[model samples]
Target chain A: MSAPVSGGDRLSAVRAGMAADGIDALVLRPSPDFRFLGGRGDGFLVVTMDGAAETADPRPYLPPGVRRVGVDPEMRVRELFGLAVDAELVPAAQVLAPLRLRKEPYEVAMVERAALAADSVLACAPELSWFGATERAMATRLRVLALEAGCEEVLSVRVTAGPGTAAPGSAPSDRVINPGDALLVSLSARWDGYCAEVARVFAVAEPPEDYDAVYSVVVAARHAGMAAARPGVPAAAVAAAVAQAVDDSGYGRFAAPGAGRGVGLGSDEGPRLRADDDTPLEAGMVLCLEPAIYVPDLFGARVADIVACTESGPRPLTTAPSSLPVLER
Target chain B: MSAPVSGGDRLSAVRAGMAADGIDALVLRPSPDFRFLGGRGDGFLVVTMDGAAETADPRPYLPPGVRRVGVDPEMRVRELFGLAVDAELVPAAQVLAPLRLRKEPYEVAMVERAALAADSVLACAPELSWFGATERAMATRLRVLALEAGCEEVLSVRVTAGPGTAAPGSAPSDRVINPGDALLVSLSARWDGYCAEVARVFAVAEPPEDYDAVYSVVVAARHAGMAAARPGVPAAAVAAAVAQAVDDSGYGRFAAPGAGRGVGLGSDEGPRLRADDDTPLEAGMVLCLEPAIYVPDLFGARVADIVACTESGPRPLTTAPSSLPVLER
Candidate 1:
């Protein structure tokens, strides 16, 4: 689903952000900012009072005497811009993140489409169990489904299935599924230029009591967080809601990290739903509300869904069968 | 193939790099440096004379240091590390690239295994053409093959097919193959912790003469670059040698941007073979030498192989049949 991007509107929004920071020029890479500004190629975009121009590298061609703001804090990018060692460089995020945090109609549609693709991939989880497939193989199939569902990029497709539990951030390995194990499939899909992420937990058979306990707490936290995602509320309120549910279950320690995050051009966007941040919620922002818990080497379970914040409430963009069937062979 | 990592050796190398830069403490993220320093985490890493510690955020945990150096010049990371706004954070690559550039024996084996996995997948390319699979479907199968071979991670597997040519950096899309269209499958697979990359071209039917011409030039450059690899040689020497061959063919301009990169714990690593970089080659270092040419909006062809440097010369780690017959219906 492609939208005809109007260059002037997107450029104006960026200029507004730059003006807020008292800057005159914005240098952008092939990030969502560049796409929003009507870039079709995978190159650098220089937006200044002189107007927007696409260039191979912006450093050599930056118009003289323009106060520039940019992203990607890598020294190499700094070198490309010929930024002197002491020259003050403003982060483009300061200018673009606000513009990006508010989703345009096209971005909302793309995020919704991304959620649909992720849900469609999980629809085949039962068959995945039937194949008695390895985690890596199942992950590969998800990649195909994600692409077919209109995902322009699959940043990561994580499938954790097998006997023992892997730590939260570990990559999928050559682990085979067993009868009483759980499956955790997480897909980070990009549609057009926006991003959407969804995660689900599956059971091959009746899982252990520990798994069932963790799943119950996780699902409760997920619901609580989604319920708190209303306009005019604080993002930390969402995190607190989820945390309260997990703590009430006496598994509070396991919920220290990975509560959830905003979903957009960057998978990990602004307004991270953590215990300490108080970024305000706004209408038209997309988010992946995830509540996860890990029992170290025993087992882990979590569920995530893409939700869009509107004036009415938090509307989930994707649907999973509310009652997950016991996926026994 | 896994290696028993003695934390002492890795720490020593990192410490030595810091000493060369006259810094006592090194702050690292979940990069190759973190892994080399015996971290099994995907988070921030801090190593000092006092010892090493892993934290969710390095900023809070960074001790009132003796002396500190770091890479990520990004404001966020700098803020996390608690460096002053004007703090001179050393580029981590400058310190770590030299260490990562020299592959330990186990690291070399992992790189070799990654290359083998990629080549093994391509060996079935003829079968893939017989199935007349779409590029998206072929990419999924390649992912499975890669993991089955030895890849603990599929960093990126890009498959470009159908009509017009896309730049080297474009993501794989859901386009079906046509009778005369060409397929370019590029993979970056991670084994153990090391990375290896390989790419090959396939034709559904007899391709146009122009496609064949670009393919000839690309393959010649690939061969020339691989032959130029040897201990004690400068990386720029390799790039220059490859450029000469491509220019001689009169199709050099089409080879802009991506000419391939180093393969290690990260898909793109150090000792970059470019005309200006003068990093010296050392034995045990692994590389992916790719020479490509693209005729915009028409077609493109390129071949990449993983090669290792040795005292004698370059050792090819991936074996595509000396002649890759066009995959046809």
Candidate 2:
């Protein structure tokens, strides 16, 4: 139930993809792509006209088998397998990354639950923030809540406060929370086999004018991305919509490309929101839009939430309040 | 300071390894192998007499450049690079994997700190056990403490109870902690870029005879693995010693080949404890011994700890008491 395509449906999807590319056999290592194929091993998976089976032991590629093409996303292992296994190794992302876009009922449920759990855990960020609270401690507390919310894994918690808020990194040390400092808490969680991300920016004291300006602009940009997202729309259109918001706000220079990315088994997978990628938005695709402004060792602002693409429009998966929170310590 | 081999020391080591094999103009993709070289981007690293520089963006293999005897680990990306770049692509692991064996002072310290943080959080597992406390809540609590201890990331937490404990997995759901259920809690934490792991088995109320027997044998096997782990010893020798303990306790079939493995910047790195690998253990090598026993759907037992190799002997880095804990309701 955790898989979008489910058992027989997945095999059918793989066969259709292989037929389109004229690929006979595939070799997958330990990746999210392999997980979609119902794999739970460090070894590689071999699929052919006959059937699919995992290698008994860990190896770089599938066992000796006749096939038109082999696929491996990682560069290191594929080379070793090319010499050992008899098959034409091809790039996997070109063939496999697209297979995970359309979600099944089970897969969609897992993603929604993951986003909800992540939202519940992140809601307590502002409460955990105060004088003397270390960024590391708050991040840990958030992850603990994520686990309690039924998440199998907490992907990453790069929440930072005070001087380290501008740069994206983790390892909350002795840097204490001080008044007027911007706090950035970014966390991702996994449920079943799906994943989602939630990011928030909080102000502990009277914020600077620049901070408010950046925060308001980023918020507008994020909402624009969400509004522009829907079935049949090109992915870049969403990015352009978000860019226009930032440009109009005078922070066009800070509008980074790839403002949003698809989230599921892989945090950065499927359709990438940029100017060039024109992959049309499809139902069942989950995307996270993160509009952030960085000034390098100075103040910053960022906000992110997971949104699901439906026939009607875009539905926000994470329900945590997205508004800027400026709390008085 | 995070790396064991600091600054120019790493390039010197890679150069030394390259010189022995008559290799020049090494091609490294974005991986822990390349990260060890102090890279900070998605692009591949091209090392030569000149220096190392990342690509403009993230790519599978090195870009075309004038150099002799290019080295790469992956075949697909190498083949693509071969078409794009101007050099011969040779394999990388045989030369690069061995390069990471020797640990520097800073790398060792980071690993030790990660182990200490992990151990402190897992120590409270016994106290958290109660009649009705859910496994999900307990796992969450453990992760929260790990973060507070200065861990930048929680790699994975596979905690299960009741019937699910026998099979390794997570999701702390509605599965209540009934008395006599075997609980397996496995957690890993990372500091800087170094990581360490710890696994413990807790018995609530009372345990079955088979569970007690498995726990005893696993603990004995872990100790044997630690005792045999030391500087100048073959990595497989420790595996053999652990195998003997399990076999003597009538659990030979359950003693897997990889009883322990190297831990550092990456969780699974360096020499693996099996019968084949003859890599000599050196001073400052951190290894984690995980001796486990799984009996299908009935019961299971596992105990693991991080041990650092030195001239004196193997020093236990993760100091969470390895004794079996039987908690009453």
Candidate 3:
């Protein structure tokens, strides 16, 4: 059984965040953010900025002094009204988003576990494959493996084959693998509430020279992006490094500009590794590196892995070998 | 394969909501609401309020004025940048909640299929009650039954026996069922995206008189709750009617107040059947009436079914016989 974290610790973390941000109170929307701060289960929690407040003390769970502004007009405002009598139930969208963008230690630990679980699933991939396996069968095996390895849920399992390789977010179908077909598998598993994403390419038969040449370039580009991850490093710099690597290898035209983003409690959050992103990487943040090059009507290749950011540099959390595609007869 | 609904028709429904609400735009968070409007996989959607003006030069497959918000802090603000952008990107929580609280014609069809799937599983419950049969074995068999009956997923299959009865929400374990022990089965199955929930009580041998008496009261209470579900009725009224039935039957001390809520696309939705809930019931809403009474150290009895409201009265969606406890010898 997993060591369930206490509700008190979660409440403390929310209080600490409110104090640091100087916000009078925090209104948690009904999402993963609420689950992260208010333990596991569905219900809303309003935390006051003050630390020394009891659950019965209605004064602490809302904006310190505001009296009228209700959070989202559409949300069940009456629920909040029942909890606290005095304070204004303000729109949490404006109050909660900025505070959630940053990460804390407990949040980082959850992300690390999510990544490790994804890595373990990928490491056991070879045993999961067989000839003439349908996309759904492969996905089922992966899901069962992830669950047995302690993952709370398999958020998504993408197994795309045949000529439809350009789309990254395609679902698994009944198609069977044939020789020379490129198989791209992307699996995301959740540990506790945090999510980890990883993708790998496989060859149905001996891969052609062109496929190997392209695979080498994509791998290099992924490492180039990983190297740029550091504390205070601009998100744009990482995107640029990956794009430049692909461009120099003559695959820029086919390469999707940005690779991936920061993975945490949600599948995608904070400091997205894209051209337009300017969020700076901070120590203890977790990120996913996915570089893709699509050739319409032919095939595409994408390699992704989750890594942790330390004061020293980026540390890869996934241990699946990234040298070449796993070719099956 | 499920027939994909036309994206254009879905977008029109969202646009109509925006016009009716007098809102400049709508921000859809990641959930069924985003899926219903965007027709895309998991992501956020921002739809502009202007209809004809925005539709004049519509994008090809993309909905007119519907912007796919990328992951960026400014993306939220940029989505509302021009044309009445000052109107906050308020969360679209209630739009789906109320709409989903009541079942649409198509949604009711899907939920009926899901409920039948649950019934089919219960039909085979006798075969699964062999000597030394573990909870996991029973759960696995029930899941297979649901899947074969065309359920996309078995959301939850809970079987509690002996000591497992004390703790709620526990997964199936390896504990073998012996003769003369009570078994409580709760299951929720999904067909397409819609879901239905059902629960039943079973005895390994002939149950005591008290068990049958308590079970009858629970079934009567469930029927009372279903009868109270009609257009313009408050949710609290339905809850109180159910609780009052149990209380009048001399089991008021064991009444657990609220029983269940609206069940449709998601297993749980709006107009919660709680004591404090005063949400007015609207026609086209489907709700699960589960009136349960738990007597500590003795027994717990519950009978649940899904019902949809019409202009005249409520219609039962699930056709499970809500009678005395099933004696499985």
Candidate 4:
């Protein structure tokens, strides 16, 4: 379901932004900004007043005696030093981040496609043999499922089981799944250059004592966040809503750092669902609303799904499970 | 064959190098430098004169009145601007690259394990069904094999077939692998935080016209590169030797840029095999010697293998095929 991208339109918008920012030039390496500007490969993209050029080196294409140049946020310090250019350097995000924050129709479609792919993998999790399988093995199985689901790239596959779920952001290990254990499976993938993430918590055979209660609170928090996502709303409000739900449930201390952030060309971008970020959500903004709770050394529950802000309301991309899935023993 | 790494020794060495370079502190994100120093997660590592500290926010760890701070080469400019530090910024590679060039005994073992995993995947290529298979399908298969072989991460899996091979650095696509097509398969993987790469070329059913002639030249160039890698030899000499072999074979124009590069914590690192790099090859330095020739509109041949430079000579880490293997139709 790869849609045709209008690179010309994006380039024009970026150039217009550059003019407004009074940026003389942009030197980008292989990054989200470079890709959005229609450049590929591990090379340099030099955007000047005249036009843009992709090259192995940016020095020659850079405007002679350029006053101010915007550099890619992803550009390495080694490459930054190697530029050997004399100019005031600024983050290219000044000109590109705003343009990137709001996804166009095609970009949204790509993200939806990626979300569907990730959703399909999670949907098939119940059919897989989870009992006696190590977390690493299950992670590998999920990765294979992602590739089979036509993911252009599998960014990350996380499988945390039993007590492993208590540790946030834990990589899959060789710990075997046992009966009545809590399991968390998350997959972030790219489909046709757009990125999306989906995560679901599960139980083996039966839910561990108290896991369902925590899991329900997590689900309620996710709903609160999504309900708060609307055009013209401050992104922080969505974060606050999620936090409020967890706090009302008396699990305030167990809440994760913040609600999920925006997802598109980059997994984590602008309009972050955090208390500190006040970027107003606009129509066409896609956010991954994930609210999680980790009861240290016991269990944790996290559910992530993508949604697009619209005039009417938030439209869900990846289908979040209505309740925790219980796998066969 | 995961070996225990003594991170303390490496940290002390980096500190000494920082002192020599007049760097008051180093702030590294999640990159090769950070991994080498034993920091985990997507946090910042601040190495000051007092000690090293890992935290989500690096602002608090900065030594008071820091003058010159070194940053990770792989750090993004966006993060750089976020630092808001009042000091001259420099690439940390100035102090880290020189020290990272030479691998310790445990690092070598980790690299060797990664190399073997990649090699095992390529070794099984001939036995797999290739007739009429799409390049993307083959790539997926290789990815699965890499994961099954215990790769912690699969960096890249390239499958170029027929005329597709003529285009260098082409991502796997839906093009069918016809009989008599030349195929190039490469896999780079990480094992226990160390990285290595292996690639091999194959003839499907039978060899394409002039393919063997080009393939042999590529093999000879790989040999030339490995043979020239020894203690006290300049990295440029290895590139020169590889170029000489292909040039002497009358396919000079088809030769790829450079010979190969150092492989360890990062798949692509320092002591690059290029005419511009003058770093000497030390006994413990590991390199991936890849040589290729892409004949326009016909086919291409690329063979990559990892080798560890030793006092005696070059020790092969990943075994390069002795001859081109032809697959069944």
> CA lDDT of each candidate?
0.71, 0.74, 0.67, 0.89
**Fraction of native A-B contacts kept, per candidate:** 0.00, 0.54, 0.00, 0.84
In the range A1-329, model 2's lDDT, one tens digit per residue, is 12346567777778778778777777776667778888786666767655788884333333345556656564344334454645555665556777787676667778888888887777766566466777666666677677767787878876677657666544555677778888787878888778888888877776655777788888888898899999898999988998899999987776666678898887778789888989988888889888777767676677778888887889887643546687666
By the TM-score metric, which is better: model 2 or model 3? 2
lDDT of 4 by residue, A41-86 (tens): 7789999978899999889888887888999988877888889888
Would you estimate the TM-scores of all the predictions?
0.79, 0.80, 0.70, 0.91
Ranking by DockQ: 4, 2, 1, 3
Q: Given the true complex, what DockQ would model 3 score?
A: 0.13
lDDT by residue for model 1 over B124-242, one digit each (tens)?
A: 77776533566667776677677656577777887887554446666666677777776687888777777788888766677655677677777788888888988888888888878
Best by DockQ: 4
lDDT of 4 at A280: 87
- Model 2: lDDT equals 0.74
Error of 3 at A207 (Å): 4.4
Clashing pairs in 2: A75-B74, A76-B73, A76-B74, A79-B74, A79-B75, A136-A172, B4-B104, B4-B107, B64-B85
* TM-score for candidate 1: 0.79
> RMSD in angstroms, candidate 3?
7.5
Chain B structural similarity as TM-score, candidate 2: 0.83
Pick by TM-score: 2 or 4, better one: 4
